[model samples]
Structures are given as structure tokens and as C-alpha cells.
Target: MARYELVKRSVALITLTNPPVNALSSAVRHAIAKSMEHALNDPKVSAVVICGENGRFCGGADIREFAGPLRGPPLVPLLDAIEAGEKPVVAAIEGVALGGGFELALVCHYRIAHFKARLGLPEVTLGILPAAGGTQRLPRLIGIPAALELITTGRHISAQEALKLGIVDQVTEQNACEVAVEFALRAVAKPLSSRRVSMLTTPCPPDLDALLEAVTMQVKKKARGVMAPLACIQAVRAAATMPYSKGIKRESELMATLFNSGQARALQYCFFAQRTAGKWTLPSGAQWNNSKPREIRSAAIIGLGTMGRGIVVSLARVGISVIAVESEKKLLETGKQMVIGMLERDAKRRGVSASLNLLKFTLSLQDLKDVDLVIEAVFEDMALKKRVFQELSKVCRPATLLCTNTSGLDVDALAGVTDRPHLVVGMHFFSPAHVMKLLEVVCGPRSSSETIATAMSLGKRMGKVSVAVGNCPGFVGNRMLKPYLDQATFLLEEGATPEQIDKALEDFGFAMGVFRMSDLAGLDVGWRVRKESGLTGPDVDPKNPPRRRQGRRYCPIPDMVCEQGRFGQKTGRGWYMYDKPGGTNAKPDPLIQNLLEMYRSRYGIQPRNISDQEIIERCLFALANEGFRILEDGIAARPEDIDVIYLFGYGFPRHGGGPMFYSSMVGLERVLERLEHYHQAHPDVPHLEPSPLLKKLVACGSPPVQKWREHIKTMHSHL
Candidate 1:
């Protein structure tokens, strides 16, 4: 609803009253339409000022309403009436003016924005273009190029930037409504013809066709499988090429195409999935809403390798004083140099001074004794981590929270080493932690609800999308990765080349294929893990069998590659060959192809040409099947958490909605059939076998992804 009052007796002030964000709900839209009519018809009212209750103007058209049929007054007509009204209308924008909210502002005769206000047309992010005259009117107001950028990327801009872009009439430090009301009073006498945005001509560039083509190519490369950005470009083109009426019609047509798309549904699900991932729950009933997190002002990081240096920078940049430790003076100096350089470069990008004063590098573990928390980022070896934890127990205060930055290690095993097991959790950060958005807060069996909350809160403070996963080997994200990688290597053994497999994955919307990503991450890391696990190397039972490890099928190809000093990009050759050490451009090596041929010949196995469909089905379905196993085992509470992990950490395409959601979209029955088919073909590969949960769900009519937790909750929870 909307509250109407006569400010200064002559100017009618209409304030939207939907709480929190004052989103344009059906009632609010109807109220605005009624208020506008009253203000326009009344002889006493000379002008109108539109604003929202509280600080926020509007978030957008009620996204909740998007799920159902179009109801209430349509936005396009409501907005058109406001723009065509005889009386002068001013928009007072604060907090956020996004999607339909920004579109509403464009129709007003004048816009006054608070200095802290953010504005943008962000419909494309939800996989729909702004269809309520936004595409047509914005280009007419600020020209085509700027409008295209704003609509396509959904990037919010500061009030100062909006002013520079000519999106707002004035920027103010005072209450936006007061400024807009006063400005509206003076605008009543001005010529309304010049202020009407729809009447204005769009500023078309000379190389408009070429400029559009360039953006199209960039969109295809950067966001390969997404459709909204492409539709947005078409809408903008219509605005530049046609009249306002025709452009608005074209914009609606484009929105219709994108609105009902599966991509839109996936994107919208992702928008909420991110919010849901943060709401961590435990079997003991301790959860996000009830658990209070401790305030962390200072922290420490042990070791100064790539992960450690990044962790140090992440803590220090967030105003948390960081104490970085190294085993030796020489190692400490090297880490210090790298940390300082990364911080400076990051600061320059964000236009802030590097927080050098918050950082302290030392060669002693004793320096970390007084810190509130300590994160161990040393080697991934259990013995080494246990020793480090035991030392920290002896040195640090009893109340200190201890964390380890391990991707796939046992948090419980690490917890057993610490005196305060309840406070020992895992804060797994992706490489270059200062940059990656994901932080999997691994909740151990003994980790207190308060401890988990603190880790999750701290990660959020450092600009990370943290998800609390159960303490298990590899946790949620990496735990599911094992089976997926196995299927990929199996394909290589069955005649598909690395490039062909990688192409299938890349075409499916993954930013990097498995082999290429392994090369970038260094092949030796997994090689060491495999060696430690007795899967390969000197510790393995070489006399037993060549391709069988314990009871399951094993691939020794990665181990062989590492044995030859081919440690990926760092060593110049892996699955693909680089130009030199540290080079990035990967070229398929004939040596790898020849090696594969010889290995197949030695095994006396006949190879067949594999179809792209098989590559995608095996790689992706196997990935989802493991996700089901993880859920059944309670390592991941819900499919959303698993999806969020992939989206932020492993470069899983957002349009696919992670593997679990993708499986649901593919139909649980179809996935079950595919897994059965593959497993029947390769009985040696246990990963290809369908998870019992997948079969159970298929038999039970395959409830949607959101409903999967009901079945998973009945099983024992690892959290």
C-alpha cells in the first residue's frame, strides 16, 4: 500500500509502505495507481513526489509474484500513466532502485538520489530483461551504450556515478524525499515536454552494429550458456532503431522469451540458493538463527605457502590484524614479500590503502599465542597438521579458536589433536583465498554451534559466501568431486582424448574442463594425496595389480605424468603441454596421446569412438550421483549447499544450477537410467553405479530438489 499526504499543501507526496525494501507488490502498485489518479484530478494538487517508506525506494517488482501468473495491475501501463501525467512527478531514490524500481525512476520528470543510494536495472541477473519500458526509456535518457552496460551486467552504481551518467537530476546528503519534494514544487512551472524521457531520441553510436556484435561475442565467450544477456542486447537494439511505442513492444517480446526460460528459473533459484546456503543447521537443532557468533578482531595463519599467504591477506584486508607464521626466516621473508604485493595490488583495484599496519609476519609460532583464532595452512599431511595443532595447544590460550584450511582433510582427526575440539573447525578457502568468493566452514562432530557461527560470520565479514558443511573426508564439495574425476579419466581410457573430453565439459558451461583445471592447480597435489592414501607411488602394492587399488578401479596415468616431472603449468607439461614453465596456454601434447595408445595396447583393451553425449552424461551424471551419496551420508544438509559450493568454488556454471539441480531438471528417472546403463557397461567402476538415494527418489516420484532434504534428514546426519 501507499500513504498519501499533502506536503506544503500543494505538492502531493505519495510514499510506498511495503516494509524492508518496499518492493512493488500488487497492492503497492494498485495504491500508487489510485494515488496518482487522485493527485492528477485534484485541482488543489499542482505536483507529485514519489518515495518509499523507510530508506529504501523499491527492490523491484515482487520477485515472489514472478512464480505465478501475472496479477494485479501490469507494471508497463501503471508506469506509462505516471510518465504521461499532466502534473510534474519526481522520484526520491534511496537504498536500492533495482530492476522495475529503476524503471519506475526513469519515467519520473526528475530524480533525486541520496549519496549512499545504489541504482541499476538488474533484471538480467534473474535471467529476464527489464520489460516495463526500462529498455526503451533508459537508452533515451542516458544513451544506448551506458544503458546496455547497466542492463546487461546488472551492476549497481553509486549516486555519484548515477549523477555522472545523467541517470539522476541531483545527488543529496539530506533525506532524498525532502529534496525531491522541494524540487518537484519548483518543477511544476517548467516545460514538461523537455522532461518527458519517452519523447527524447536515443543516442545511437556510428558503429552501432559493430559495437553490438562485439558485446555479443564477449557475452558468448564469458557467459556461454546464458540467454538473458543476449535478449537484453536485442531489446536495447530495438530502442535505438525504433520509436518509443515500438521499442516498448519489442522489449516486452524479449522479456516474454526470457521470462519463462529454464535459465531464468535456474538463475532465480541461484539467487535464493546463495541465501539458503548460509542458513546452516545441525542434527542437535543448533542453527543459524539461534546460534550467536563470536566477534573476531585478530587472527593468525601458520605457514606461508600460496594458501597461507592468501589467508593472511584475506584476514588483514578485512580489518582483522593478522599474524602470519613461517617455520624459517627465509620462508617468512618470501611469504611476507608475496603477501605485501598481493595486498597492494588488491588495494589499488578497490581504491583503498593496503592494510600493512594490520599485518605481522614472524618465524615463531609463539607470536600466535595471543591471537583470537589461528588457521593452519601448512602442508596437507595429517602427521604434519597434527603436530602443528598439538604445538598450538601448548602455546595458545585455552579459549582460542583453531581452524585448518584443508579442502579434503578430516576435521575430526585434526580436532582430536587439539585440546579444545569444540573450537577446532575447518575454514577451507580456494586458492588465492583473497579473491575466491567461497569459504566452506567445515563443522566438525565436536564443533560447538557458536564456533560454527563464528567461522561462518567471519567468512562473511571477509566477503566470502560461506557454507557450513558436515565434517567428513573432503567435506561436501571435494567429496563429490572424486567420482566425477574418475568418470573423466575412465573416458580417456575408452578412446576419448583429453581435449575432446574437455570440450564436452566446456560446451556444457563449465569454465574449465577437468584436465585443464588440474593442470592449472598443479597435478602433483593430487599425486601426493594419492601416494599418501596408498593408491600409487612407492607405498602402493605394485606386485598385486596395475589398474586395481584395494577393491576399486584406479587410474595411474596422473601418477605417471607426475613421475616424469610433468607437474602441469609449473613444469610445462601435463595432460597438455605449455610453452614453458609457468606458461598458461595449454596445447594438447602428442606424447600424452601416444602414452594413452600404448597403455590401451598393453592392457589388450579395444577402444571405441566415444560420443559427446556419453562424455557429458558420464562426467556430469556421475558428479550428481556422488552428490546424492553425500546427501545420504549427511555430509551435505541439502542440494542447495552442494550447488552453492560448486558455483562459487569450482566454476560450475550458474545456468546449470549445480549438479543436483541439474539432475532434477534432467529428471531423476532419466539420471537413474543413465547411471544404470553406464554402470552395466563398466562394472569395475563403482562410481558409475547409481546411488540408492537416486533410485529411491525415482521410485517415490522424484520430488523436486528442494524437497530432497526430507528423505536425507531421515538418515543419520554427519553434522
Candidate 2:
């Protein structure tokens, strides 16, 4: 795990040999401890330089070891021994030094970082504080304020930033190991007392109490119920007030508190879940590692609306030439300017020149004839999409792949319109595609494995967390949204106001409640979808009872709101009122409250009190219930894929895991019972009923979310 040798006849070079990120596994830690001992005991060694073999410094603790018992020398004492060594020890940081790795660098007498290197104490992100003298040493090296920000946020800083903050002694453009070795040679005769960070007094601000209080408030407000940041703040406070010995104890205590916490487990599960989501698989045995993805040098986007414009920016920034199409000349010009401005601003932020020269805007399909792939981002109408695909089949070459940016429309139906049904797939990019990290690669029944692979790879290139999902209405993210949204509206009808319900969900860790999210997303979108489905408006049979559509109970409240031209933020009114059209600040509107009261009176139904618990159970349980059904239906391959979609596409809280994991954490038996109770109470609502998969899992002893795919193996698979 580690290699040691003498260089310059006086300096010992210790290089960590672990491949990839050189995570501090038990073996690697043992190796490091032994190597340090040899360097310190050797009479000829005057100095030591430590670095990773493959340019990357340690990424952090081996998370795989987290589930096992500690088997090697403990990190804290090992790091302390190195810090107290008689020989000067220098850390040569190259690609990254994070978490325990950053802690490793902290204990060294000196640090030299490559200009492109990154460093951070990101233990807080995993629901733990830095336990290896990081909280104590960092506050002493940098001031309390800067240390608090870095430790609390777990944000990585550039080598230059590390230099400015005194985290690293120097940043070099050349090889960091060479620079560190030279630095270690010159430091052999220097006093080591001042070089030891833990010995330095923490730079205290005058208003220490107030500053700590302010940061505490900010953390609480931003993260809500998250525990790690709060613990990090407390650790930093200890470093500011207590001796190093006491401060480090406090840090360890904080880490212990977080290490076993459910929140910590959830965060760690999320970390792995994100990585697992990338390894897509199909029933045909074609998977991520085996399937070959075609190289996309150039692509075309149909329609130049919000989604299309964002798609263009996403492609151009990644060095792929994009041809954006529009039906009208005026719309084409407007989209052209928007795409250019967005690309330029994005480039400015990234410190790179805009790739605007790669973009082509036109009102003709002929411009896309030679493109490698064509993503139709027109309106989410199947007929319109079909027409576009038909046109593309005629315009583009036979080998070109065709993709649709439809959120819920049928991918196979659109495939049927093209000559290449096997090439047609869904690239469902979330709104503001350039910013959102999620892309659902909807694999149609006819979609070839190669086509799916290409879309997934392209999504990765665009900096998206793409999950390959089977073709179905709404795919994974939005398909499950139906029940969730239904439960929220039903609560509103049962006397819970929008604010009350939104408050309950937001307190439950959702960034926004259903109603508030709907307002911002534009209520007209769902309203139009409902109308098109004949659930409301002229298409509905007048013979059917009011508030009842087909066989199940329906909420006409949204339709009524839309009828009044309330289309959410864009119209300055929806479930809540805004200051003006295009405004964001949403306040409860009296008009909505009055409408609800009149609707209740007209139906001769009594309004009842609804508890926050009921709101959460009904809404979230319904969401998870749909996820179980999706799993049973084989639309999603695993619970993790569904969770990833929610995490990246939707704003599911990280600490709670995703809906599927949350359901498992809540205990499947309890979920099934609650769902059964809800179903009995509201017999007219089908969504409240527990799915068979949930019942099966509960009967099978409610295994962990990770084990769910084993049970789902017998079910028919779409991907």
C-alpha cells in the first residue's frame, strides 16, 4: 500500500501506492504508520516527503471499511505520531486531498500543492466531523471564521485558495512531490514547534460568541434538521476555546455521535446510491461496462423553447456542435440570442471562452441532416413529437440516432413514426436542463442497447446523473409524482391550507411542498395535462358526478384555479399569489381560501382538522407506494435508480435518503399498515392502497432497500 525510498541520501520519500484515489484503507493506514516509523528511526533520514503514487493524493477514508470493525492502527494517533516526529514531514498534494487525507496533510510539518490540486475536510458531508485532529488543527492554522465555513460546508478549495488560507505552505505549477521534497530539505534545520499546527493558538475573533451564534443560525436555517453541520460548529467552538487535547476529544465525541446516527447512514447510503445509479443494466444482459456507446461529435435539438435552449447550451459547452431548430423565424432568433447569452455567462463563470461558434440556429430540418443525434424538445404532445420524428427520419441519415425530450409521452409511439424505431429513446431532461443534474434515459421496448448506452453516456458528458428507466408515462420521477400530488390536493380539499401542508412537508426536509413547487413550475402545465386526459373540461362527460372523474375521486380545485387564468408565478397567481407576473415570492391568497370554502359548501362536506403527521403520511406514503408499484411493474430496475431520480431531478432531501429508502427506514410493515388504514378511510382513492410489492416485502421481513432487487428479480423487466 505504500513504498518508501531514500532520495538525496538524506530525505526519505514515502509514496502511497493505492490505485485510484488512494483512500486510507486499513492496509494503507498500516502501511503509512510503518513507513513513518522507519523514516523516523533511520539515522540517515533528515527529512521525509509524503505523496500518492498516481498524482492523486488520498481521497479520504475507504468508505467500504466503514461497515467493518477497525482492524489497523487508529488514524488519530498515527497522524499525531507523524506530527510529533523529529524529522520534518512534507505532504505533496496533487489531484485531491480530502477528509482524512486533508487531515493527513494537516499533521505534516509542511504542505506543497499542485496548482490544480483540491483540498477539503468533507467529513461533515458524510454526517461526521473531522476526527483526526482536523477540527483542532485547521482552526489553529486558519482563523475560526474561515475554518468554520470550510468545515461546516465541506466545500473543496483550489490550491491557490488553500495557499491564501495558509492550509498549504505553497502552490506550485510543477510536480508537487518534487516541490515538496525540495521544501522538506530546506526545512530540516528549521524549528518544528511553529510548524506544528496543533501547537498554535487559534486566532480568536472579538465577537466569538456572536459569530458562532450567527453561523449556528445559518446552518439550522439552510440544512434544517441536519446534524453534522451543527456538530461541526460545536467542534470548531471547542477548538476556539479549549486546549488541543480537549478540542480533539470533543471532535472525536462529535464524530462518534454522527457515526452511528441514522442520518449518517442515510447520507452514506446516498453517496453509494449515486455511484450505483451510473451502472445501468438491461434484461438482455447489455450493461454499462459491456455496451458500447457511439461517439457523438455533433447533435441537433428540435424546438427552441426553455428545454431546447438549455439542451443546446449543455451540448455546446461539452464541445459537441449543436444545431437548434425552430418552426418560426422570430422564435429561432430569440432562442439563438438566449442560447448565446447563457453560454457566454456560463463560460465566464467557468473561466473558459464560450463555444458559441459550435452553435447553429435555423428554422429548417435540413440543417440537422448530418448530425449524429437529434433530440426533439418540442411541446410534450405525442402527435407533435411523432410529426417531428417523421420529419427527422426523412431529413437525417439512416444511421443517426433519434431521441425525444418528453417527460411522460410515449417513447415507443414516437419511435413508431421513425424509420429507426430501435434508435428512438427518451432523454427526459429536467427543466432548466443546463442546471439540473438529472436526465432520465427512457429505454423504449424497441430501443437498442447501443442507443440506450449512447444516451446514458451523453447525459454523463453533460454533467447529468442519468438513470436508464423503462418506457412508461412520466418515467420514474414523474410517474410516481401523480400519487404524491394527488395526496397534497386531497389534503387541501380536507381543510388543510396550502401553507400548512407546505410547512409540514418542508419541515419533513423537502425544499418545497407540492403546492409551492407546482406554483413555481407553472400550474398550467399539469392543468393542460389533466384537460388533455379528459379528467376535466369539455371532454369530461356531464353525466359524471362533480369531483369524481371516471371511477376515482378527483380534485377540480386546480382546474378551477386554472380557469381563472391563475397559472402560477408566470401569471402572478396560483395556489398562492405573487407580486407580479414572473415573480417568485409566493404568499397565501385569500381568493384561494374563499374558493376552497365555497367548494366545500357546495359539496355539503364538512372540513376537518388535519395534523402535520397525517399530511406527511398521506403525501409521502402515497409517493413511496407508487414507487413500489413502479418496481413491481419493472419500470425501474432498482430502488436506488428511483431514489437517484428523486434526489437529482426532484428535491428529495439527502439526509432522509430517497423515498424508497425512506419507506424502508420507516419499516415496511408500518407503511403497509398506514397505507391500508388510509385506503379504508378513503375507499374512493386507489392510490392510498398499498402496492402488492410493499405487502410482499413486509411479509418477507422488510429487508433493507438495497436487498429489494432480489425480491423483484422474478418480475417482468422493461430495462
Alpha-carbon lDDT of model 1: 0.91
Predicted candidate 2 versus true structure: per-residue lDDT over 241-339, tens digit per residue: 999999999999988899988888888888999999989888889999999999999999999999999999999999999999999999999999999
Evaluated with lDDT, which candidate comes out highest?
2
Off by over 4 Å in 1: none
lDDT of candidate 1 over 1-719, digit per residue (tens): 89999889899999999987888999989999999999999999999999988899989999878889987899999999999999999999999898889989998999999999999988888999999999999999998889888988999999999999999999999999999989998998988988889899999999999989998898888898889999999999999999999999999989899888888888888988999999999989999999999999999999999999999998889899999999999999999999999999999999999999999988888887888999999998889999999999999999899999988889999999889999999999998788899999999899999999999999999999999898878888887888888888888888989999999899989999999998999999888889888898777786757688988788777787788899988999999999999999999999999989998998876889999999999989999999999899888889999999999999888988899899998899999999999999889889889999999899889999999887777899877
User: What lDDT does the true structure give each of the candidates?
Assistant: 0.91, 0.93
Q: Which lDDT value does model 1 have at 337?
A: 97
Query: Candidate 2: lDDT of 330?
Result: 93
